[model samples]
Target: MKNFILFLFLFFLTNSCFPAIEKPDDYFYAINKKVSAVVDEPEEVKKIYTRELQKYKKYRTKKYLISSKYVELSLRKKDKHILVYELLKLNDDKYDYVSIACNYNLALQFEFSSPELALQFLNKAIQLDERSGEKYFLPHLYHQKGRWYYNKKNYKKALFYFNECLKNLNRKETLYVASMHNNFGLCFDKMNNTKLAIEKTRKAINILENKPSKTKEERLFLYFIKGNLGGYFFKLKDYSSAEKLLSQELNFYITENYSSEMINPSKQLFELYTITNDKEHLKKLIDFLKEGESRLKTTDRIEINKIFQKYYAGINNLENLKIYSARLSQLNDENTSKTTQELSETSDRLNNFIIKNINQQYAYQKRKNILLTSVIFLAIITFAFFILNIKTRNKRKHDSLERQKMILENNKKMLEKDIKLQNEKIKSLYHSLNLKIETEKAFLNSLKNIKKQNNFQTEEVLKDLLLKVNNLIQVDKRNYDLISECTLQNEYFVNRLSEKVPNLTNLELKLCMYFRLNLSSKKISSFENTTPNTIRVYKTKIKTKIGLDRETSLDTYLKTI
Candidate 1:
């Protein structure tokens, strides 16, 4: 029992000391890459949780070294506080490598936030990796540098890095090749090289399709490629192809609830429908847009508004077109101003750094450099400084212009609000006037009802009054004939007939009443002192207007009514 207890205690102690096995170097590198994709920087605690490099030997292999170097680089770039603690704990030999790699990574980190520093670190990383023969990470380093250049809108340099990545593609790195191709397509698309963009995107799609299974990241990229293809077709005005691809992409977006994929296809469809002059299809597309607009978040509303504006313009709905266009213009102005301000700030920082560097160089050159070289360097630096300063001032001026634009937008919005209020008032007044007119018509109808009721009580008196009133109003003789003939035996039938034939001429109403009572046409003609042919003609006209075929018995239909 003592021996068994000792064994169990030892097991527990070992297990407690070693909580969990750390993942392989490749695994940590992949995890770090994924985290970097979604977040600007991972927190120190998150990095500590994710990275378990201490569990493994420090200098296992060139591959492990590179991966470990990347982890430290990522942590330092993110400015994780844990880095200081980790650095202090490392052995001297490992510390030397970490220090150099960390410095190189620091340069890369600054490349995004501070390009000058990024260039310095990239150079250092290249030099160090060259000495160590750690070329496994060169592709990634190049890709990142390319991304930096892309952000700076230096397309040619970005392409150079992408091409470098392409050159490194092999059987072991198929996924990387696919990713580079996708990135290349994006760059080409931005540069408006549609043909090359399509070619590269197609290549990406092919790679994704052949893969047995895809991660979520791969699927997202695939969907993006599909959306781009749809856009390409749309731009070419091959709308049938555009619609098919866009519709497929739209379905995918709906299933995934991806807001980013919703608007472009909808706008493309709207444009296609407009071009085709398919009114029914256009209406359906409009309903789709409205639904998407309602579902979209506030950040996506600008895109929704753009689509709506295009749709409205296509339909020639000028009022809404103008409203959305104005809104778009306001948003653009605000964005432009913000961008200009940011650029100016960045330019100012760059200028300050340049000035400080120049001053330091002057100090050093005073001690070491020859007179001619120093003069030439100073002249070049002075010219560059003045040019950069001018650019900064212009950017600031642009920002000021943006501020003026905001003021104008505010005034425009106020004016629009006043106009809207006035329009509402006008609509309200029109409605009120319509109601009044309806009320007057109803009062006149009630008066006519009262006159008819009194006529039933005193026939002789009513007749004399009717004759005098009809004469004064210049009532036609035919109207009297119509009224006289419409007197039916049943009041219900008379009331219903009156309701049905409200706009009927008096003669026609009378004929209708007789017809409803099952009176023969000849008998009606004799009663009315007219020819049977005339009665037949009037009945045919009434039947045609009422949309009743000759086969439908008018008398029977009227009786049922």
Candidate 2:
């Protein structure tokens, strides 16, 4: 009894002196902290994340539950479809915006593949943030929305969203800001604002280059921006600077074995070599191209083959030129067919998704109507029992229910109309794509026939053949259907303009319609795949033809007409 009392006393004394460390039931947060610390090292981040995921078979917190699955799904190297479906399955409507990880990530997955779908996800995230009154992720979300517009080729909208993104940022000197500038450069480049493109890209490069202890991702981005700056220089005919920058980029990509990235620098260098007649560099680049032929995509292969054909033609190598010409024609046909098929499949998927959404909404509406009816029945019964003599109250309640029913009916009709319009748009787009494919096939067949002609062997003959192909393609006529549709929507604006000018060409009429839509010269150039300066010259010609004074605004005048 004395020894037992002594042992109990010792145990109690020891427990009081040194307390045990308590482990958290929700230990995933701790693992998350560690993962964040080593995020710059992808391998270590993956290892730590995998270990924590395996250790925790079930997460105790909502945020970690979604976050862990996000990490796991990302590590699996899944495509956008699988990522979207899996992440959406994990989303709970009851959870707060901060607790859900799928919204932003799913937006990223859809950004490149289906920008329309990506916009919906981005808008959902923004809505959630607004509902929660939280501005923490607003900047990132705005940046993503800007990317969505950028992918859709709506540079003006992209710039608007990017400006919003910058406005929300707490710090201007960040990787995100650098990324924004890089995006602005790309947008400006597409708009044929090469000088502005160079400025923005240089700003991005300066920001990244000046950062101390740069991360691997940042360094890679800097290389990409430099390569893009080189492209801008190439556009400006600054061959010396372009060659220097592109060479460095090519070396970086080669060392990293980035096959897809290799194509851009290679393409630019090939063009530069052909222009400068640099046979020495051409031989070296040709070797790289030959080695990487199997890895390049069909479209890229076609592009390089054309370059080779041009290079060989310049050197009077008839045999090699003919070989490349044949290869280019065949590759063009194959790529056209493949692209057409892919577009058809994409259209089908989009239609199915839209139809599925409509069906879901219809079902939801039916359920809502049933529930509303039940509530009204219960309310009427209660009113009857509580106020049997109050006929006015009963009448008012009945009128209110009728109004609600009318509102629901109106909403349902509007939704149906919207669905109809959307389906029509999809069908129109599909038809246009098919039309383009047919036109390209015709153009390619014409080229093949021209090449087979005995008279096509001379330089002048080849030049004439290219000019004939250019005339035969009828690019302006190809876009006429789209313009016609726009005209119909704009109250026959094209027809009205043609009547008013009486001397307007088809292209000038199209330009007038574009101006009437309030499109900028930059936007018009992008649409026509021409330079802004060329578009400006066309604008001048239109003003002269329309008999407008120099002081009058052409776009504003067209809008009035």
Candidate 3:
């Protein structure tokens, strides 16, 4: 008994003296990375929580870190109540990382349920992250906020946030930058600047292509961008490019069993084939659509039926056209009947409430009159007042409901009419422009002019074509101007940098100048016609040549020089 007591005391003393060591920053970072890597593996994530996170429960900073990770995992699993509970438990002022993570995670959670709530959380996250000054997740937060604005159809605000995201991202975050460009494309697409939309989307593709993907998610993201680009191409009537891109995306979706995603490419193909009078492609698309009919929403089904009606009518297939017309009418009636039934139910409820109120008032009035016959005048005055109040209240309620119903109907009609007008306008513009054929014609005319003027002088022809190409691609002049401006502004800085790092190459010197101007590797890569990864390598080499330690920031160092 004495030995046992002595051992317990010693154990307690040892534990009290040592306690559990707080995890270093590197350990925390590694564990965070590990959790992210195994997030898709439920068993692995469970093991991580049990073996690693559970041990740190008593430490405040580490505890919050674990809680943040749990919240993130809960979000992925869509465990809403648990996520909310965890978020509520977190002390936002206790740790900046935890606070930012909580707000960001909660914002994502609220995005589908309440966009306003999502915006509030997102703004808080941004504010806190910015104030913290580390900016580890600032760009991602910006992108999420941009996505929120995009979903709300505030394309201008979405673009602003997306541009901010792009401005803050570095070359190392290639995938994120690519996503922001894709968002830019989406915003431009919504704003009806299809040309600019196509430009941004192509740039996104180029960036993704230059950076090899290491995961299925990244590849899928690339395909998603391609699909959007294909739609943009279709809008611009570049049917060949559109056909190729859409076809690839359709095959990918079918193979991946992404039935919902399959509808978009299928619909675009159906329209394309009908417009081009390609019966072959139309029949194939029809087969695909019929096979996946159960996967489509009612709106999608109605749209597909309309497309079929147009196609069959165009081909003079009267029987098929009649069949599709019947289907379309039935679908429309079904959709309309749902709304009508809802309105009828609402009206019935209001009538029932009014009747109930009247019956209650009648019962009370009868009791009052029976009990107060001796004071009949007073009773009459009280009953009149009661009846007048009820009537006035019911009248106000009835008027309010009627006004709301009328307003809703008016808004619905206006929205439908506006959509119809917009669709008509787009179709007219597409038919009138015929951009592809017109552009080809213009180029051919230029070639003919060159042939006639130069009389087949090969050198002159080449020179003229070169001049036209240069005129078309005028971005180089802007780049040169920027470089010149940067050089002039940082002349003393450049001299200091050159004196400090005398062996720097021309490319390295240029990179230093760009760094001084705070240009990201992505932007510098564009100017240099090289990959961002290569620019990053040059940056590291510059840091080494300038004798900056690993802990020192190259950007800050260059600024000081």
Q: Could you say which candidate leads in lDDT? A: 3
Worst 10 residues of 1 by lDDT: 10-19
User: In candidate 3, where is summed lDDT lowest over 10 consecutive residues?
Assistant: 10-19
TM-score for candidate 1: 0.41
**How well is each residue in 1-561 modelled by candidate 1, as lDDT tens digits?**
122222322222111111123333235435444544544455753454344454335443434434454455444545553463344234222423444445444554465468876776666655654454434345555666676677788878888987885775454444556767877876887798878887887897888878888865566556666767777777777778777777777777778877755766676677777887878977886677677776776546677777767777666676676666666554444555542444434333433343334436676455344444544565567668778988999999999999999999999899769545643443443344445455556556655866777455566656655654555343334334333333233345656766875545668766876676566788678678999899999998777656578799887777555
Which of the numbered candidates is closest to the native, going by highest TM-score? 3
lDDT of each: 0.60, 0.67, 0.68
Clash pairs for candidate 2: none
Q: Write the per-residue lDDT of candidate 2 for residues 217-263, one digit (tens) a residue.
A: 56666787799899999999999999999999988877877666677
- Superior by lDDT: candidate 1 or candidate 3: 3
A best-first ranking of the candidates according to their TM-score comes to 3, 2, 1
Prediction 1 global C-alpha lDDT: 0.60
> Which is superior by TM-score, 2 or 3?
3
- Error of model 1, residue 412, in angstroms: 57
- Which pairs clash (backbone N, Cα, C closer than 3 Å) in model 3? none
